[model samples]
Target: MPHLHGRVAAQESVFARMSRLAAQRGAVNLGQGFPGTAPPAFLLDAARGALGRFDQYAPPAGLPALRDALGADLGVDGADVTVTCGATEALHLLALALLGPGDEALMLEPVFDVYLPQVALAGATGVTVPLTLDAARGWQFNLGALAGAVTPRTRALLLNSPFNPTGTVFTEEELAGIVALARQHDLWIISDEVYDELYFGPRPTPLRILAPERTFTVGSAGKRLEATGWRVGWIAAPPGVTPGVLGLRQITSFSAPAPLQAAVAAALPVARDAGFYDGLRAGYAARMTRLASGLRDLGATVFEPRGTYFLTALHPHWTADSLLDAGVAVIPGEAFYARHAAPAGLTRWAFCKSDAEIELALTRLAARPELTDV
Candidate 1:
């Protein structure tokens, strides 16, 4: 293991491990962030339409129609869009294209667990900077900490807006600070905006509008349409960055599923209707409110999620010291960070579940009130 690359070693399948645990224990799974339902009906039908027609491999840069649609949605030009298997492949491609041995990349602490391993695998050093959420103010990027962490060796900054785990979306001001940092350090900004459309309120415009050349956004059709298994995701970077992305795309999977790309192309025009995404935002907002209020009523502290379908609970008074076995399978907060990992008492939940499922999960949480005091 010592001789193996740091990236591959760091990259254990957290979701897979927890999924098996949930299956064995019959724990209510708030562990994974994907919806357990089939993708939107219209999107599914569109894929079926392409089965016999577009079933073959697509161009290495991705299908033009899908790429063009992705560009239109992100407000970038089509030349900047390149589709991949999922955000997983898109991120991997970006890391490979932009990073190399001895280079350094900065990441926010409590980020998606998959990222640290990917950065290490790319032969780059992973720098984890913490984002502190004060009970009164909410979660915020620690700019000073980020600034101090950057050096000439730092080549990129990877961030997910509408963040996972914490679900903290950046304000316009926060975006500016980060863009400034990128400009100051000449760092590539890898913006994971998979949850961009799942925001609670006020849809955020991608910062690529501000620094088009320096930012690469990873977008997901799966999260956009509750179609996690569809696995159609894309990378939208500046024209200058496309060649680097293409270079990696050449050796790797090369292209995405042609049928899924066609489906995504068909789904895009429908998915981008302002009213459609607004309805999505509102529904998730309602769910967040429901779960946050429920957890609070049970005397558990809830960290309200802003963008993604996730929220954190700080069981400040839990008696068991850990909550994994309490018929609820929320991930411990420590799994998200490399340093200052929470020892226990913090759990991450997925609100992407159906309303009924969320209610049932809440009931299970209420049933275990005694565990909070142990």
Candidate 2:
């Protein structure tokens, strides 16, 4: 057998593990983040109608129309947008452009799982600044830790607002501090804003809006339109940084699928699309409430979700694997953190499940009296 690279050969993702377990057990899965719904009817119609529209490869930077739509949506110019396979690809491209061996990237702990891997794939060291878990303050960003984490070797700051697992939205005041730190350290800001539109409280300000020159922002239609399988996303960078992204794109996947690009372009929300934003928020908010309420009734300490489809709750001693044995599957929160530590007793339940799926999960969980005894 041939040798394999350590980083590339790492074990299957926690998602893959939990999903396989779910299949084996036939458990009601809230373990993975896949949304249960499809995109709005208009978006689906656009895709279905695009069957024979454009058969050739999209431009390496993406379909020009899709780029333009993303530009307008992001308050940037079309020329500044580089569409990629998905937000994950966009972030990896940013890391490829920003970091290399000996460089250090700063990120929050319990990050979206891919952040660290992307940093590693860049051959960069990832330094984590944790968000403090405080009931009074909610999950608060620790600026002091961020300030302390910076060193001369720090090359980038990877940030995710409306964070996963915690669901804490980074406020303007917090961002102002981050901006100051970035300015002081001359670090590139690779902001993952995939869940930005899902905010339940105050809207989050994209880091690009605050520091366009130094920030590369990533967004995805997968989350925005609930069409993960379509894999349409864009990286909005300042004019100065886009050439590097384009260069990376040319050598990579070359371009996203054509029909999906056109479909996304057609259905993307513009300033006039009030109904799209309103309806999206209302639907997800209802799901979050239902899931959070259900978990609370089970004596779990549920953190009210501020954004995204995930609801984080504390389990006294339950592992997601054990939960699968109980016929319910949720992601064990420890999987999100980079460093090994005692499990935080947290489980992130994806409320993106359909109403029936959610009810089934709740019903199964409710019958497990061992859950509430904790």
**Best of the candidates, TM-score:** 2
Residue-level lDDT of model 2, residues 229-321, one tens digit each, is 888888898767788789998887899999999988988864238568767888889988998888888888878878888878877857786
As a whole number from 0 to 100, the lDDT of residue 59 in candidate 1 is: 95
Model 2 lDDT on a 0 to 1 scale: 0.84
What does the lDDT read for residue 340 in candidate 2? 41
Where is model 2 more than 4 Å wrong at Cα?
270-274, 340-343
**Candidate 1 residues 264-291, lDDT tens each?**
9988988777366777777778888998
Superposed by TM-score, candidate 2 places the C-alpha of residue 56 at a distance from the truth, in angstroms, of 1.7
Error of 2 at 100 (Å): 0.8
Query: Cα RMSD for candidate 1?
Result: 2.4
Candidate models: Cα lDDT each: 0.81, 0.84
